[model samples]
Target: MKRTLTILSLTTSFALALGACNQESPKQQQEVSAPAQTVEKPESAEVVQDTIKKSIPSEATGRIGDASIKITYHSPGVRERVVWGGLVPYDQVWVTGAHKATTVEFDRDLIIAGKSVGPGKYALFTIPGRDEWTVILNKNWDQHLADEYDQKEDILRTKVKPYSLEHPQERLKYRVEDGGEAEAGIRISWEKIGIRLPVAGK
Candidate 1:
């Protein structure tokens, strides 16, 4: 009987030890799993953005006397490339801007370089030169990059001298400057060059 009792006690002690080990294993697993729940994920690739446009739509509008002048064009950056006499060849007609032909709109009758022009929208083209630049106004304002430009459709053509600017202009820009009274100046500036056209109420 003693031997049988000893065997029963041994069996109960072994079962109790095994039960303690099993309970400790679950606690260990919980501790390991709790740390995993608190771990943070990496966020290196979630905060990047893109911001660049090749050709941007730009506008210059101002009123001189009773005439309202508006110029719409696509402004392109210099981007460290050659401008005059290289990208823009001398004596060749250029759209004066990028993508589409630069357009000028007049709300009232005006005189451009002493030539009378009625109120209308016209495409502005230029033949860039080192000393002189030819500015042309065409009747066909709705065109793409001077691809459909025709000399026969030209309304007025005038020569203007290109001047150097003190500071460089990174992007092409056009501005309508009020020249007092019934006069305004149309200025195109890019790189280090400046071209101006004088206009007055007619």
Candidate 2:
């Protein structure tokens, strides 16, 4: 009876070891399977505000004797801002308009305020003052504002008096008027003031 009890106890211990080997642990089973892949998403882009300069193109054509004269420029609005002695300053070179420089083209040789200017395209620049203003005709017709303007390139410089306007003009304007037989006027009007430059064909 003692020998039979020993054989049965040994068999029970052998069966428990076999069962534990057959069943895998939870951690071991996870390692045997394939790993999951992770994907990253793209981020959204930010929006920015656009800052654009808004200006309008203006053109004026008139006759100086037999010669045809043309003036082209960009017009800027007052927008309730102070024009002379404030936004434009007292005595500094101005572009005379917004954006690009104002251009005047003459088909023939002309005399501006007793100064002779050849027949070509010229950029119009100005120095605004309370009483008088200096107008310039530069050889560099294609330029941005007055940043690259050189006083040495000026073909003609004339001084004229500023005229007070009865009715205010909201936007800047240029007009080529026929004064008489040999005389013509180039008028620049903006806000509450105006200036006229005399030109004669030669």
How much is 73 displaced in model 1, in angstroms? 0.1
Displacement of residue 162 (Cα, Å) in model 2 is: 0.3
Error of 1 at 39 (Å): 34
Q: Estimate the overall C-alpha local distance difference test score of candidate 1.
A: 0.90
Off by over 4 Å in 1: 1-53
Please report how far candidate 2 places residue 149 from its true position, in Å.
0.5
Model 2 residue 67 lDDT score: 66
lDDT by residue (tens digit), candidate 2, 1-202: 9999999999988898887766666556666552421112233334553233356788989977666889999887777678788878889999999889999998888778888777899999999998899999999999999989999999888899999988998788999887777558799999999999998777
Candidate 1, RMSD to the unseen true structure: 9.1
Give all candidates' CA lDDT scores.
0.90, 0.84
Which pairs clash in the backbone of model 2?
none
